[model samples]
Target: MIETYVDERDYKLLERDRYTFFVLKRIMGGECKLLLSDHERLILCFTGHPFPVWIWTADDAAEEEMEKAYQLAKENKLLTGEYHFNIKYSLAEYFIRRAAEEGLELKIITNMFAYDCLEPVRPDTESDGGIHCCEMKDLEELVDFMDRFHKELSIDQKDISGYREDAEEFIRSGNMYLWKDEQGHNVASCKYAPDGDMASINLVFTRPEFRRRHYAENLVYQVTMKAKEAGYVPMLYTDADYVASNACYEKIGYVLRGKLCTIG
Candidate 1:
């Protein structure tokens, strides 16, 4: 049987499951709803956004349970949306097969790597001087970088005003940071979204002219370190095929926790 939970208190039930950490955090923040099966062994999060349907299931979940979960989602109209699915690779495949049988199609599939660090992240001393929190004065540059970042990833780009508002919120919250050149040109940026004891690092970006300079890596390292100092476990997700990003995160002490897949 499948059950739905919208209360924030139920998030504690998922505390020990890192695979569900991001979704649980979002749910606690009122950004999504949770659907569970078999007493939370099967988890699904629906955000009603363009991102994806985030899900996790126990390795031994019975095939019938998986079917029931999908059926539940379908009945709730969650399976009729255009959003993608972010889930364990095996489960992604299972869902794909099931969707095919239902005559539904997914547009694209990508493999991803999830990483987490419990220890202090070490930043490169050489790249430390230019790293600092973003300020309102840096809003325009930050928006430009964000737009470029989303474009590069093939994600739909938000307007400058939207990016500006987002950057402003991040700046006001003191969670956004940028690496600047000696001349004060922003070269790289990164941010962390904190949720209880866990924080997810995201929006790491470097301009084309600044590529291969270790700026993004150093910025991420700084953010991760800050998160650790604040008593939050730092985690991040990267494209499995992106070798440089994977290497950079590993160099900063992020360990691969598992594989994730997105089907759009």
Candidate 2:
């Protein structure tokens, strides 16, 4: 059932509620609404405003018209877009291309749109390493942790940082787990997505001093367990060729459901 709600805050209110696969449209913290699977108005309420080219969602197969609409909307200073594409028509590349041609900033997220990705209830006991899981529950500590991680990885740029709101949001609404070293510092960290029934692992980072120690395996196993306990399936999306992460996902029992290619 597709419904649309007018208030942005109201739309995201379900972030902690419902479990349906859905999409949300929040225009600069003003109007918000929920969208059902087939372009239904799950709950759409307009803040009584549509002066902007409010693109709640679009169909990729209707590319030509969609692009034209996007161009018109953009030129008129009314272009905000939300897209939902599965493996069948995964528009990661399409969105990247359109964003460039239309001068829009786009973020692409890929998930288990092709397969029912599952992880072992726990790690293989026969495996040499063990598991470690710790939740940051604290935002300050998370930022500090990221700072140290960036330094350890030699990731320069003073302005280069992860999303502050995302970290805080995850700490409150999601689960944050880390693989620990003997000294108890995190060797790797994976913050699950805020969604209830699905897990999207992000910020998977390993320190230079701790690379290739099966830290990913430990961290992934720990995070997956948390998801299981929460009654949600644990999953992740990463650079397809991130050898360590890809191997870790396989080691923990995730199948290659499909491939995601992004232009930007």
Candidate 3:
């Protein structure tokens, strides 16, 4: 059965698979709107963000557990409407098949990558720009970049009106960075969200005019290095169909770990 949170015991179960169920750490620590779990499968939904509902199942989860998980999701309106789902790779096929069987459609699938190396394989590529932490003055520009980042990928932006707050939080946390060109133009930007020992590098985007110049790879490498310095392993998820972005992360020593099925 699904429940909000029983007690610290719930977190203990998650700690058993810390690395595999990385994002749960954030939900457990942050403002998780609703957390439904049966000790083997978990679902985390946000309260004030447009992010998707994240679902995870233990590797040894039983079929019954999976069914209960799916039922919980459906009952919460997570399976229909404009809501998106970020489902664990191991359960992707099950959910996809189930959705289809139930007359639901899940369109996109993404690959999750984790840095496998002890250190970044620094690209030899040089840039006339330097990376720096985002500042208060950069808020407006960062919001614009965030907009372009989502739009370029055809991502849903119905909740974009809330990006200003998101940008502020990112900057205030000192987790967001931007690469400024020789003339001091913001050419690329990236941010990391730490969850336990893993730091998720996301919202990475380089302007179109800066493409093919290795700006993205270089910027991401710097971010990875920062995360490494802070004693956290770097990880990210990229669109499976985005060849160039996937290749860029691969170049930075990020290997394919698993995937997430994104359904909207």
Model 2 alpha-carbon miss at residue 170, Å:
3.7
lDDT of the candidates, in the order given: 0.74, 0.48, 0.74
Query: How would the candidate models be sorted by lDDT, starting from the highest?
Result: 3, 1, 2
TM-score against native, each model: 0.86, 0.56, 0.86
| Clash pairs detected, candidate 1 | 107-264
Local accuracy of candidate 2 as per-residue lDDT tens digits, 1-264: 322324444445434322222222323244443222223222222222312112333323456544443343345333355332322123344455677776777554332221224656344542234444344545665666566655653322233244455466566664675666677665666766635466655567766677767676667667666676678766555555557667667777776654433221
Give the higher-lDDT candidate: 1 or 2. Answer: 1
Better of 2 and 3 by TM-score: 3
What is the overall TM-score of model 3 with all chains considered together?
0.86
Compute the lDDT for candidate 2: 0.48
- Please give the distance, in angstroms, between residue 159's alpha carbon in candidate 1 and its true position after superposition: 3.5
Clashing pairs in 3: none
Task: Report how far off residue 111 is in candidate 1 (Å).
Answer: 1.5
Q: Write the per-residue lDDT of candidate 1 for residues 65-142, one digit (tens) a residue.
A: 677666766776767755677766566667778988889875446788878987755656456347879888888888
